[model samples]
Target: MSRIVLITGGQRSGKSEQAEALALSLSAHPVYMATAHVWDDEFRKRVEKHQQRRGAQWTNIEEERWLSRHDMTGRVVLVDCITLWLTNFLTDGQTTEQILQDAKDEFDRLTAQDATFIFVTNEIGSGGVSENALQRRFTDLQGWMNQYVASRADEVILMVSGIAVKIK
Candidate 1:
């Protein structure tokens, strides 16, 4: 059987840190599956910072999309963030509904394997509503995706001010 853990928080709320700690506790050499797509030098540097934080015990895999292609059976896999993963699909020229359904389907396929999944995600919609239409749309998509993942997760943690509060 598979186990899912969802960690969510606002920006800079230590969601990744919590996920990393949980993954390390579960496995000595956990799989660090990053879903970020480096679009520029600044973003690349940010990715490097994250890479530097992890020790040599982690097996890193960078996949912008199609996470179901990776067979992570019997392993502990930590997916850094759902926001970036969703962003990758948002640009595919598909409607929001289509993209959401595809994301949910992909998530289902990936979690079907007998492994432990620790998912890190941002809670962007908790604040004030976005003024931009695109931001609003993305926020909605992200929120829905987060909810979907959380529903399937065996445990859910909400990070607030670098503190983890278990919600499920």
Candidate 2:
């Protein structure tokens, strides 16, 4: 059976770093699953920075949708975040239920493999309520997504100011 670890936190809260460390500890050659869809130069720069940080040792996989369709057997996988992945669905006009079902589908397929999955998501609901409708909708979707992944995860961690707090 596959092992699932869910890590959540606010922006720049060390969630990705924590997930990367844990994945490396689990497997010598873990897969870095890049889910970000760069929308501008700034974001592209950020992606470049992350790529530089990971270096050539990690196998990078650029996938934005249908996560379960990928073959990840016998490899540890690090999904830098559920937030960006879900955002892709939302931007593509996917309904909340559809987004969730897709996530669940990925979970089901992943658990049947021999891979160790580390998922990083943002705890976006903790901040003050959003005034924009789309922001609000995204927030709700992110919350639900985090909950679903955490519930199924063997280990759940919350990163706060670069410190990892074990939650499950």
Candidate 3:
């Protein structure tokens, strides 16, 4: 059986740090599966900073989408975000419903493997409604995806100002 853990919070709330720690506690050489797409130089620098933090003990996999393609069997895989992963799908110009369904199916397939998964995600809908149409759409998509993942997670942690609050 696979163990699924979800760590979610607002921006800069330390969700990734907590997820990495949990992954390290579970396995010495946990896989750091980053879903970010480096759209510019600044973002590339941010990705590099993350790589530097993990040290040489971690195995990093950069997969923007199609997460199930990678065989993560018998390994602890920490996906450092769902937001960016979903954004990749969004940019493909798929309908909202289609994207959501695809994400859910991909998640189901990935979780079918016998591995421990620590997912890091942002709780972007926790604030006031966004005025931008695109932002609002993304927020809705994010919330639905978060709910789906949380429902299947064995444990859920919400990071607030560097504090981990168990919400499973």
Q: List, in order, the clash count of every candidate structure.
A: 0, 0, 0
Candidate 1 lDDT (Cα, 0 to 1): 0.95
TM-score of 3: 0.98
Which regions in candidate 2 have their CA more than 4 angstroms from the true location?
A: none
The 0-to-1 C-alpha lDDT of every candidate, in the order given, reads 0.95, 0.86, 0.95
In terms of lDDT, the poorest run of 10 residues in model 2 is 103-112
- Each model's RMSD to truth, in Å? 0.7, 1.2, 0.7
Candidate 1 per-residue C-alpha lDDT over 50-102 given as tens digits, one digit per residue, 9 for 90 to 100:
99999999999999999989999999999988999999997879999999999
Better of 2 and 3 by TM-score: 3
**Candidate 2 lDDT, 2-33, residue by residue in tens:** 88999999999999889989988888888999
Instruction: Name model 1 segments beyond 4 Å from true.
Output: none
Scored by lDDT, model 2 comes in at 0.86
lDDT of 3 by residue, 1-168 (tens): 999999999999999999999999999999999999999999999898888899888998999998999999999999989999999998788888999999999999999999999999999999999999999999999999999999999999999999999989
Q: Which residue ranges in model 3 land beyond 4 Å of their true spot? A: none
Error of 3 at 103 (Å): 0.3
TM-score of 2: 0.95
